[model samples]
Target chain A: MTTATQVEKEFILNMGPQHPSTHGVLRVILKLDGERVVKAIPEIGYLHTGIEKTMEDKLYYKAIPCTDRMDYLAPMSNNLGFSLTVEKLMDIEVPEKVKWARVILAELTRLNSHLFWLGTHALDLGAMSMLLYALRERESIVDIYEACGGQRMMTSYIRIGGLAKDLPADFDKKVRHVLKLLPEKIKEYETLLNSNQIFINRTRGVAVISAEDAINLSLSGPMLRGCGIRHDLRKANPYSGYENFDFEIPIGKNGDAYDRYLLRVEEMKQSLSIIQQGIDGMPEGPYRAHVPGVVLPPKEDVLYKMEAMIFHFKIITEGFKSPFGAVYQAIESPKGEIGFYISSDGTNKPNRVRVRPPSFLNLQSLSKLVEGSLVSDVVCAIGSIDIVLGEVDR
Target chain B: MEHNLNEIEEKILDFLEDKFSGSIISRDKFRGDWSFFIKPNDITLFCKGFLNNYELDIKYLSDMTSVDWFDHEEEKKGRFEVVYNFYSLKNKIRFFLKARLPAENPEIDSITNYFASADWMEREIFDLMGIKFKGHPDLRKILTPDDLEGHPLRRDYPLTWEQPVFTWNKDDPPEVIK
Candidate 1:
């Protein structure tokens, strides 16, 4: 007969409700097996602002600004996704010029997001010098965003029927300057990490998820493509005139943290190609659609013309109604396919709006990857996953 | 990419045949999005068959959420309606499964075993809606603190949070945020 052994010596550790490493108000309950993670449970919601429920009451047009703060890094992507869904339901079309400009700006937004990811991902892996170099270039992208839309981060420039306004005259010059400089900067990052034995050893085989497992986990964007799934939403189901642009989807043969990093670097190159194409073959037409009720008139026209003033006032105070239907529009954001699932019941306010954010989905596989791995490698795996807790917790 | 939604509905009904008696499910297809209602008890079985037997292969559980039934309070329509969003990697289609549960006691089977992604998602729904998930390996408040009292996202719950909004433009006037 064998007596039962008591395991009362174990202790639970509270990692964070506010630790810098936990990444954005994320709390993790860590049950330790002497310095090893026995069970890692992520606790969130310290930043739950109830934005989804808040969207239920606000008018559809008012909700555009709300989506920006959800994933602050990829605000334009969120704006584009939401606007595309609204346009799909309304069945309204913007001018060819507006469409192309949207594509260009959205791609630029992708650059901003990817640069931040690169800097932060490397910084998390203890490459602090790389972060400063990456952010130096990232500041220029933010300057472009501000110059084009008059605001940084929360642009809210991508409207339902069209853009908030036309692209600035200097937009092309600025984009071209960044385009010329970005390749060299990217190569600098690659040279620092690509051949470095330490970085390669920490990331090359760490958090290696197979292609089938990545698909099962519903990981999208570079994470899925890094695993060789070749599932780029932009290439597969293009929206916002992405089908018209020409660009290659870079896929990694190895499914690891290093592959994900390489895939993102290659994707930035592809994004530059698409933007250049969009600008070169850009069509000439009006910037905004002809839907007066749905979209706001230009500021000049609103101030000068009586008709434009009334239209703008009505839209600002009492939003327009959308047709009774819903559409799920997913765009290939830098992190992954950022999808907007919108439902309207023929009201000024939306009946339902659910964001299928890819970061949230990609973060699902953390346990699957980190379970058996060394505790020290958890940060590298998380950085490789490239999750934005703002979007994830949202 | 396109199929007769009515025919699909008929097929589903015929497939599930009177096993769930008087389960007159109302399915509404808006645009291309498909949504069907199911009883709380039958949701687990229906979802199982919907994924496996029907070749939907919606192995990816995208998201799970819930809404309070306060608008339908007069109809005594219980309390909450849990919504599930699934994307079938095989067919490239998405489906919305809604289960209406009693407000008095909202309970449903755990789909985590079927879709591992549902592990955290179900916890989120439970944290926000207070809907209990039976057989969930470790169901707890996901997006909220463990010591938190109520589900703060309910209709009755106020959105007037205590956090202050930071503004870079000092000239900007303060707006009353409801």
Candidate 2:
């Protein structure tokens, strides 16, 4: 007869590639010693579409649509990041109105992404009705996106030089309506999740990473902020007139699953305030910058004037030539820093278009986050990271 | 609390010149971010020094990626440039370090020892661009199948559509109609 200690051994357990709690098609191979995870190795690439390779073959103006697919949840934020990088490469200044409008749209995108994350994360923890309630609020935001740019999800409204078109007539009214309603809805969500004993037990003190470890791991946005390190790129490296907006960066203390949840809730409220400020201080000017042979001519002008027609034809056919230089532009997307390292070769097509996806980088910390936690906490830890595998495997 | 951007850039440049004088190949500033081009062999030492230094405590590795410079004649000193973007939370500054590697055998020293975040990023560069990292603990394909043939991001790789697996000729399709 053998003793129980003599027979004990560790075995490997594959958690995903199709698991519901992974937020996308992500596989985590966890090594377990009777329900305690000894090692967690993330396996990706199930959703890879080779978007970066495809971007290198397309023209500069045509690549904007590709960025939207990288982070499908925060399409507008992806658009803004890619557009801002191209604009920097071209060294053209967009109109004041365009900057304000971009800020407002991107903030709305942050709120939309956080709501989806909250709902899906809650559902992963067995709260079924939260998905329906969260989706109800998300519908209003999607309606706003639809009102501005014809598509709700993949609205590549933010173009390279400026916005694709002027804001709709009722854009302001629709946005204000949604902004007014989101706060109370957020409050209801907080009442449901916060202080609930079951929710607390599942989240708090689970997957705790120190501020030092968070920084060393290069975790950003909420993951770094959850560790009580205030490192938001919007405030640190302000771009697209983020400097003009007055808002607070929310920080969390515990760096656990619960702190991350609270931090995103606070971020949604701050995004609301930014939207209100952007609309209140909205500037009036031309929607797009007037860069000949680069920015597209207005449709009416292209129809009427010969010079406008010629410019449009040239831009559509040959695309604009950027100076032979490289620029790295990062924007604080809903997830974290979505950066575009664009190396233009004095041609219409980019030499190299590398996306520093936050999900891909943030997902690196999952092993550290769930090293010694329970198997159940593995689900919570993955949910707290809020990774969109579309972005991760892009 | 707002430090002068130019002064910070100058300070970093001076420190690099003072320590490792001849290693820097070229330096440029684009969009207010300082970029330095260095030899591929010196990246490990430079990254270690940058992380250990007190004034330039660039502990955060923002991004690590590789760019293929295939066609440009004048700009092609090397076929690949592995770029690393680092950020200093204490000083609120961002910097770029690019290491030039030859196209035929692209390899560079890994910085995973300094920043734990570099593990996945290095793996990604290896998988997509075929650039190997010397000391990466686990270097495998991250976003591609294990048996994927060629590096997709290379300029020479064909961007054509995948071939259809099955096709039906006229003779093969006629039997199903009865």
The parts of candidate 1 lying over 4 Å away from their true place are A1-14, A324-326, B1-24, B50-56, B72-79, B161-178
Worst-scoring 10-residue span by lDDT in model 2 chain A = A1-10
Instruction: Please state the CAPRI-style docking class of candidate 2.
Output: acceptable
Candidate 1's residue-wise lDDT over A11-113, tens digit each? 4556655765556765555555555666565556667666777777788888989888888988888888888888887778888888898888888888898
The candidate that wins on TM-score is 2
Whole-model lDDT, candidate 1?
Answer: 0.75
User: B102 in model 1: Cα distance from truth in Å?
Assistant: 3.9
Q: What DockQ values do the models have? A: 0.25, 0.40
Q: Residue by residue across A210-238, what tens digits does model 2's lDDT show? A: 99899889888899999999889899878
In candidate 2, the residue pairs with backbone N, CA or C atoms under 3 Å apart (3 or more residues apart, or in different chains) clash, namely none
What TM-score against the true fold does each predicted structure earn?
0.87, 0.95
TM-score of 1: 0.87
Which 10-residue span in candidate 1 chain B carries the lowest summed lDDT?
A: B169-178
